[model samples]
Target: MNILQAKVLKSCLNSEEKVLYLPGNLSQFQMALILAESSKFNSFIFANKYETLARDYVNKNSSSKVKFFLTETSVADFLPIIDKVVVFFGAVTPFIINSFGKIILTCLRTRTPLYEVPHGLFQTGQNLVDNSRLINTDSFYDGVGENLPSLTNVKLSWYGENGFGYPRTVLKDAYPARVIPKFTLVTSNTNWFLYSLSDKRMFYKVLFDYAKRNSDEIFIWCPHPAELLPNTLSHSVIEFRPSNLLLYGLHNDIYFYNIESTDDLIPYCEYGISTVSTCLLDYEMHSKRVNIFNCAGVKNLIAAFNHASAFNSSKEISHNAKIINTGMLKNFDALKFDQLLSQEVSKENFIDYNYLAAYV
Candidate 1:
């Protein structure tokens, strides 16, 4: 936030008033931290799954005092009294979507203001589905990255730069995955997210087998929260469920970490391994070597889902066939909650995703 905006927001809010924070996904949760840092206030996190990266951010460090809930509607009692509502990212989950709809209605009924901010570009396929549910917002804030397809009626505020500065050093209380001297960053999303590419079982088997075959090189398995969160996609997910024996089978060289963001693992290792993750953009920013897996599957998904206007949609997919490995990476960047700024966006930009969710 700029000096003028912060001052204006602080002045509009009375001493006892509270702010509502609703982050769409774990990675986008960073928007809450940035807002809290700029404006000290109380916050509420909606549907942040247990043990996920976003949940870790709540438990460890935050810019403002925070309390999390199981769903967005859970905050209904608090909404009436809230001075302002800030949706850091867009909502994708069913419960989050429903609750956010309620928040919008309450805001409209009570004359409360809402702000929606963009955490990143609309890389996630749900951009159209999730944003379509949002009928109105009070203000809109644009970030440093690519702008959302232009908004016609609402005023757009430019944040100019992402608050973390460039080349994020570290988040407060955030830690990197533990590793022996030489290890590759093994990150992935569950098959539940990418229904079209049902390869979770095969992905883990290849990872575990590779770990056993190459015990000398360390592997840090940073599984995405989508794989761990409790969900009801059992029937569909069974297609690629990994064997329990493989999950428990330990190769001493392989390890895992419960960190806030996978970016925390970057400083520890140079080269990395993954399937379909936007987090690979972090590696690209560092100019590091990225070992890609399931090149054809990743390409197929891209060709299958790429909307006419998406840019850098799958930055992780290496065009060179030589770097291809034998597994699937997760597309954790599929869901996002824009920053907590309110405004209307050009609805035409949304991709109509009917097939695979593009989930990680």
Candidate 2:
């Protein structure tokens, strides 16, 4: 830990009130900010040494009252001060398990409340094996169980039953409804597609072709924050990096809206396109029509939507555009959304505070 970081944590340790520890990624940071503004807990936003983008994002989005910290701070330094720990992606990477896992362990030892907040929507059992490979289990602390330390003794926001032992909390729809645009293309990074697809470039080609065929429609392409377009794909298709385009800004030609999470922009889009991404599930929840490109076959994608009854009710838009309609979900009520957001965490169904501490 850096000397300056230690000093920062030491200065903030005066409060006995619970501290909500959150990773500093744009998604997690946004979630933390929402929770902090609505709840009474003080938040500590942790940024990895290399996450310059994340740090900048938090600075821009967070208010003056929000606290920021370097992830290098010692777990021992946090143990005494932190009464509650909230993790976004749990043990998905070695850096995560090492940096954030220590704080979770500390919370466990101290019997502090620990909550596992999901950063993505499609975290079903089908992808657990693929996601778990990112963890370096060999480095786990002594006496830890075979399961990832972060998964044990934590409250989870799960959509379906897949057999993880943690207690589930139904995630109330938080996104507000907006006027649906003509068309939107949601892009994910090749890093994830490369895992299950043969030729990632082919995926982009198909996507570009789809966009070009529908050039007449007012089209908006929202690429993943880390998305890298392949050289083979037409450069003309993607107008600008999402950061360069103004937020919710309009363009006469094909537009690339500058935004962070696709979930944030989904409400404004009418028809959407993407491969098997969690955001598609979110779009379904919002009743937005989405086309799941079958570059990796539809088997996995079909299984993902198995729990969603609305999936079967969707009509096909094209051979590729599996236009799923999620109208089955309750209509978005602005008052209800606000109520859910501001409702006290105590009222929600969470893992027993005692069980969360010692279950592992």
Clashes of each: 20, 0
- Tens digit of per-residue lDDT, candidate 1, span 1-360: 111223335454455646676666656566555554444455565544533644655546643366666655567766766766665443234544444555655554454555544443223321322222333222111112222331112211222222222112223234435643555666665432332233554555555555555556555666655555555232244334323211211332233444335765655664666655655545544445555455323445434321211112233322231322212221222111123232332333222211112220
**For residues 229-295, could you state the per-residue lDDT of candidate 2 as single tens digits?**
3542224335522332222335333433454455666666766666555565556655666666453
Any idea what lDDT model 2 has? 0.47
| Candidate with best TM-score | 2
Decoy 2 TM-score against native = 0.56
TM-score of 1: 0.50
Cα-based lDDT at residue 202, candidate 1: 51
Residue 84 CA displacement from its true place in model 2, Å: 1.5
Query: How far is 353's C-alpha from truth in model 2 (Å)?
Result: 18
